[model samples]
Target: MKRVLFSAPSVRRLLLAALACLSSPAPASDRIQIVTEELPPYNMTEDGRLTGMSTEVVQAVLEEVGVQANIQSMPWARAYDIALNSENVLIYSIARTRQREQLFKWVGIVAPMRWHLYSLPQRNIQLRRLDDARRYQIATVKQDAGEQHLLARGFAIGKNLQSSNKYAHNYEKLTLGRVDLWIANELNARYLARRAGAEVPVPVLSLPDLADDDGLSMAFSLQTSDALVERFRQGLKTVRDNGTYATIAKRWL
Candidate 1:
């Protein structure tokens, strides 16, 4: 069984921090700037713009609560760097890890990301235990939680393949005898697989569910005002209650 490091206690701490931010004063009313990568089933680009479940949920909630929002897309690593250095900035659907737990003010962890791995079924590759993955050349996106997990466990990964949306090319690499394993979110990997017609059945290894605690969060800067973050949080709640989140997720997933 894969043990998820972030459980109830750490999640409660993050929530408490969010609550504290919610009760404080906001700095300015300019616009909340959010940055995300162009990844599918979470954040994807259409017509050269970012639109997906996480994006739609956040945008709808902020609009509903009367707060202005500006969203942009960049590479995942670059987006994270921008969010860290820039003010009035946030990132979405970010996994909670030891490195990121205390980095920023947080809000609206909509749901836990169900993560897994895929390998050719005929190869009989299985990862019932994380230790079983050490021998294979695991491939994942740069700066993703899946990579982080494997690295922490001392798994030596393969070469840097190309960067494509949703690890689609990685799946192709595996199919064409280029890689041993592909690590990504369950829903996201499946979506990408169908998009590429890589219908070769692959084994998926399930990880722990973190819905009650380690779901997606909008991580804000320390300098951002509390009131504005509170507004977005409340707006996210309104969107969820009003079924905007569910609707968008249904349409996409």
Candidate 2:
């Protein structure tokens, strides 16, 4: 015959406890922040929103697993630097290197690339070995994998002619003889040649496997909790096992 509520002091205490728990981040959740560059066919913006093959793939995987994360677009160097120091931030589409092999926890393969060296017509330098690069100055976009790969291999590269406009100006550097050779991805070189109305080599030279570097994946922050990394890894395996990853890959590639 009577309905009574908890005492005022008791109710107040309960509310405060609940609020504290809600405010605290999940043990596995580190408030993830992702930074990506404007590399086309991978990460780029459309109508001021982030959208591309790698971008879409990462967003989908995170959403499927119900993780709260944000992706930011910025210059490649800046993004990479920030990701290195910031907690829970990852630089997507990163290449694997001996120096970086054990640094970050990788999630899933996002994309693959077939790298090539492009030369302007009539000036194509022959390359049969990695040592062949030493004889000529190579061109690459700044802080790009190509740049890192070449420089690390002890080849002298031209000034960091790398930019988001890599495709547009790279050919000029080679054609005008600014640099001896330019390294480019197959798709990007073709895209640029078509837009510039210039001719790219009929057959791009393949540099013997500096690194496989295929399969783009999220690189979890070193500061990210192991539990979170493991969770994402598990989630990725689930997606892959179910063919969800392949399905998503087909949508873009």
Candidate 3:
């Protein structure tokens, strides 16, 4: 080929263009902030490391999509707020609700969760209906799906509802009799109860209205691009199809 060389001015222009590209913001997919809460068997920080069923599944999905993010575990309230106000932020194991349907772009469900009222066996707390829970003090993680669920059903904070930054705090309060009821998923309640080293097992009370089955999913901020959301959705399917989802669940479930 004949020699083709750029003029000095052309070379300068090319250099300037490369600098501009380097200084520009990252693409939406590369800016994702993935967040989760410390819930055993799902997501948690142990021995200064983050690992759990949901964490592994999320990692697998991101790998399938060729995306990477630091999966940080923070208080549920703070994590929830960050996912709500910031662009390119994703919160995992979030319960999908009608009220939140429009607030965020939801990925596929990660796991199934069922909420129940837990109390000490000797407490004899009778919870036949949802309203019945209102008569006693209840503890829940701040800004958690269970807390929102109760709030939507008219549970008042600082009165019948005691919100904590961590589920362990609520379990402690429940075991101490400071809170008459602990609102948590069946798996979480059992996990927290064991972790709390409770001498007596916390028994589940019947709450017909609150017994509905719910699911946890990765929810992206409304500001995230639709293409990125779809990528994650499809990546989740890939993991499930490849049996990675089952393998992760087996490790925890």
Give TM-scores for every candidate, taking all chains together and pairing residue i with residue i.
Answer: 0.78, 0.79, 0.87
Off by over 4 Å in 2: 1-30, 157-177, 194-198, 201-204
Error of 2 at 64 (Å): 2.0
Model 1 TM-score? Answer: 0.78
**Residue 132 error, candidate 2, Å:** 1.7
lDDT of each: 0.70, 0.70, 0.82
Pairs clashing within candidate 1: none
* Residue-wise C-alpha lDDT for candidate 1, range 1-253, written one tens digit per residue: 9987888999999999999999865446646677887667678888877777788877787678766667887777777777778888878767766667676777767544676667787778867876676666766776666676666666644433233344666677778767777777666777777777866546557656322344666678766788877877787887888788888878776
Error of 2 at 3 (Å): 7.7
Per model, how many backbone clashes are there?
Answer: 0, 4, 0
Best by TM-score: 3
* Preferred candidate (TM-score higher): 2 or 3: 3
- In candidate 2, what are the lDDT values of residues 1-253, reduced to their tens digit? 7997799999999999999998987554646888988766677777989977777777767876778777998876787777677788767877665556676777767766667787776874677776666666666776767777877766543343333335446667776777677787665566557656877653347854644565555787687888877777777677778887787668766
* Candidate 2 all-Cα RMSD: 3.5
lDDT for model 3, please.
0.82
- Candidate 3: list runs displaced more than 4 Å: 1-26, 200-203, 206-213
Clashing pairs in 2: 110-216, 111-216, 141-162, 142-162
